[model samples]
Target: MVVANDEGGVKPSHGGPAVADAAPQVDHGMLALTLGALGVVYGDIGTSPIYAFREALVASSGGNVAEREDILGVLSLIIWALTIIVTIKYILFVLRADNKGEGGTLSLMALARGAFAHRPRWILLLGMLGASLFYGDAVITPAISVLSAVEGLNVVTPTFEPYVVPLTLVILAAVFAVQRFGTASVASVFGPVTALWFLSIGASGVVHIVDDPEILLAINPVYIVYFLANSPEVAFVTIGAIFLAVTGAEALYADLGHFGRRPIVLAWLAIVFPCLLLNYVGQGAFVLSHGGIVGHPFFEMNEGWALLPMVALATAATVIASQAVISGAFSLTRQAVQLNLLPRLEILHTSETQSGQIYMPRVNMLLGIVVFMLVIGFQESTNLAAAYGISVTGNMLMTTLLLAVVMLKIWKWPLVAVVALTSMFAVIDIGFFVSNIVKVLDGGWASLAIAFTMALIISTWMRGSRYLFEKTRKNEMPLGFLTEQLAKKKPQLVPGTAVFLTGDPLSAPTALLHSLKHYKVLHEQNVILSVVTAQQPKVPDQERARIEKLNDLFMRVTVTFGYMEQPNIPRALAICRKQGWKFDIMTTSFFLSRRSLKASPTSGMPLWQDKLFIALAKSASDATEYFQIPTGRVVEIGTQVAI
Candidate 1:
């Protein structure tokens, strides 16, 4: 989809010119991006097999009857579930929804908002809210993925079983602790490890398949029908379990900008999807053969030495999955800041070359604390799993609704085709949504809490923007009118360069206004440098920076990079120096205004919430130094405004 920046002059850079077109070269190998995307993208979906089949068996009562029919039925349902849900729907279809080669709720939202910016107000609000819920999903992902992985030990050792909560806590603590170092340090191992992990799952399934060859019949549609026909209630609850397998399917799209959509789709279709199915089949086979072991049959599948390796492998896989979610949270935060929904926090790029692999310390630390508390509160992965599916399902529901709009309103597809296609996906999503509702009282509230928090943030940003628009004088000082005034007043003032750094380029720059009001001078060479952070994993140096001349004298140059990237303004200034640009850093001072927000009764929002949001903004946002501005020649301007 074509995505336009809110700032009118800047063009969308899907496969076009990017802002950082002049930066130094850094080559993060295709393998590194692939593995990093794999590590981050596959977390929740990777660990789904741990509970998906087991929960389904428990719901079906097929666990107590280990007959050939039961095995066939369970295997069929699982195989078809993987095929229809993960493979066909998400990997094959929905991954195509890209906003200038970027995918995710935010990218999709940006695309939608930009397209319908001039349309009705409801469309904008709904799209923004949907994107905001993704933040909540990011928080809940790691907590549940690691928790479920640690729970596997219960089947191996009874003593170890009770320590699942503490162990998950420790694992999460370690996961969050390592974020400051960035994934570049461990990028080499993720690919081979996750590849081996999938192989092991396939191997485990092969062993079970050898015992009962007839279990292969479970791949047929008959078993799914039989299970559903027998007990609709059981099938309904199993929807929650089945949805787990496809929980992180959207990550295939969300992380598409990092690895590109092709590689991710290839990885999911080839290595990830097949192995997940094999494991589910294996689990189903074990359940069929030993029906009465419903309570914990996953661990009961093997005996002696085999049990230990399986347990160890599952733990490692779980940790890997959790690591992915943590990294995703960092990416989401960067996206939020770029879209202006959240404050700019310090973002550190671990690798100089690979822009996609980033490390944000604040997000890491906050997620660490939350995941640790979650592990202790839930005490077991299964319990945590109850909270896991809700956020993803909610996101999918939003996607389903929005895709309908995209097809009908945006794409202008035939109404019949749109309804037919969207209705099918909606039904599948609603099944998962209803199933997750059963978990609402069983630790499912955590994701909801996080979603509400993010919703508040997004809502506040929108409200604040509206307030600023309403209160500001429209004709008080126009840039075009002021430029005409400057041209007539001082014809000789147009010789040197004046660079103004701004938060939003389309909006009137406070720095520019201050200069016009105080100095009464305008440079012949004016540079409006806008720095935009991309949400993807890495944007190439060629894609990071850009320069455009606005009628010779007024130039608007923007520097765009990933959040995981470093800001080198001095080095950039040096590049400008090579171009014969003249500016004395000491004499040509930098300007930063401190916005003092006051809560007025005028804004149609809850006063308490507005005050809380303002406080949160003040406390949570990083200082100006975080954006890498020079301190010596900088001038601070504080302005008060009522909200």
Candidate 2:
């Protein structure tokens, strides 16, 4: 079940308040489904304990300090960081920012667009920036999540140390290899596996807590306060590390359409939160007793009989994390296409049962290459950690800002409460954001590079679209104006009927320009056929076909349909035949303007970016086969255009 946000450009009516076939069921079966969803979707955030604690400890030391205080301070930071960002901010606050009960970057963007299309342009920029940052996070997530999981192998066995990189690569390869197959059937196991994984983490922590109950004192906010107040400089760096704990929290919002709000929220509150708290507590206890083992404290928490199960659970959790991001990339691409940031692609729904299980080959191949490169480039999970947290933090900050606008303008929440709550989040988000800025030169550039590239593409597409629309609107003739002239200029020449298919519904299409330029004669009877693709999934066949007469010569026609649907122009002709529409197929030439977009300065994009967009357009372009236009009767007129 995947419910699109019922806000945004071309909002599709999906029945009434609750859409049919949206949001996967909430039941015992879903409990199992939530595991897999949690496993893959929640993997990045869930497995942060593997390295967050270690990095915070290192940052706290600043290369010189007592290992005990460093361990305690770092552990306290991770625990409280999770409590504030995940439990309070995301779980308690941000989750409430749903767009017609749908969540995610796309959902949020849709909500903003619907409410603020006529508002200041800065609001749209914020929405796009958040979307761009999400794409950046998508690229880095798999790299860090799998790397962290494989790093655990080194902690358990010395022989496994040297093979961590290769093993992580292998695991990633296997995860991506199965993406085309879809996860509906196999997803049943995700909930149980993740459930056991979190439970095991909690149980392990309880054992350590039993041994050293005094470590529980770190849970108080005062310890976090003390660490921040006493070590302001070093604590800034800890902001970078603490962000790792909530890396996958965005997935909770992004994939909210999959499991619905209730199941996901319940799963997070009931199962995921408690286990995560326990694991952090156990790590704190382990750090308190044996602060000497500073390199990988998470691995040190387990010993003897427990180490092997811990290893197994961590690996399973890592798989879940990787899968979540992969699925997220697909959904994001889908949204991109719908919103026109991306060109059309072959979007294949993997499951007849679950519409959310989608497969995009171009996206999958690209992301797989990038993830594999990150694995080999970083060579270790710990190294990749530098690049991971910054993008997630940036995205979180973007979300907080966008939600403020939503609360005040859309939901009409009181300005004071929205400002106060958003300000608190802004302070925390900015602190983490500033901390991650220091990591820009230290492997953080990868995520930044990705963000920059995506932003460039999105911005270019948006600007180019505006330019194209403005240019067309200014130059092209409106249907009513053209029809009025046609009635007076060529009353004697009107004998046969001619239908011209147009790209734009508002103005006379480029196809008509090419047709009039090539052929000097005008037909007595003229029809302007414009197709309007609704954002909805289905349009009734009858309602999809509409015909209106323009003056006496021009027939203004429109076929309202969906991108997912197959157009039946021949059947449409059959219906028109009954109305005595003179059926002369041979002379009725269907014109289509094929613009040859150039990668030059005139395209309103950099040369490289123009080339990238052109290449993406070519790769994702729709084939002529699906449009139902006649093979021989259609003529494509080529025009070299800069856009």
Native-vs-model 2 lDDT?
0.71
lDDT of 1 by residue, 215-302 (tens): 6677788887887777688677766766766777777777777777767876776778778777777776666565435655555676
What lDDT does the true structure give each of the candidates? Answer: 0.66, 0.71
Looking at model 2, the pairs that clash are 35-190, 35-191, 36-190, 36-191, 39-320, 40-320, 494-524
What is candidate 1's local distance difference test score? 0.66
Minimum summed lDDT over a 10-residue window in model 2 is located at 1-10
lDDT of 2 by residue, 1-643 (tens): 1111101111122235877779954577666556656665566777777777777766777652336555566667777777778778877767777754557775675566567545455765776778778877877877887787777777777898889889888988998899988877667677677778888887878888765677787766777777778878888887798788777888888876676666777778787888888888787677667644566767767867777778778888878777878888787776665555655556667888776788888788888998999989999776787898778888888888888887888789998999999998899889888898899888889888888888887776656555545555577788666667766775445356666666555577676666676776667777776555543334566666677777767776666654334344555655555555665777676666666666667756677767776665555544343355577777677766565
Q: What ranges in model 1 sit over 4 Å off?
A: 1-38, 62-74, 114-127, 404-413, 473-476, 480-498, 501-509, 512-587, 620-623
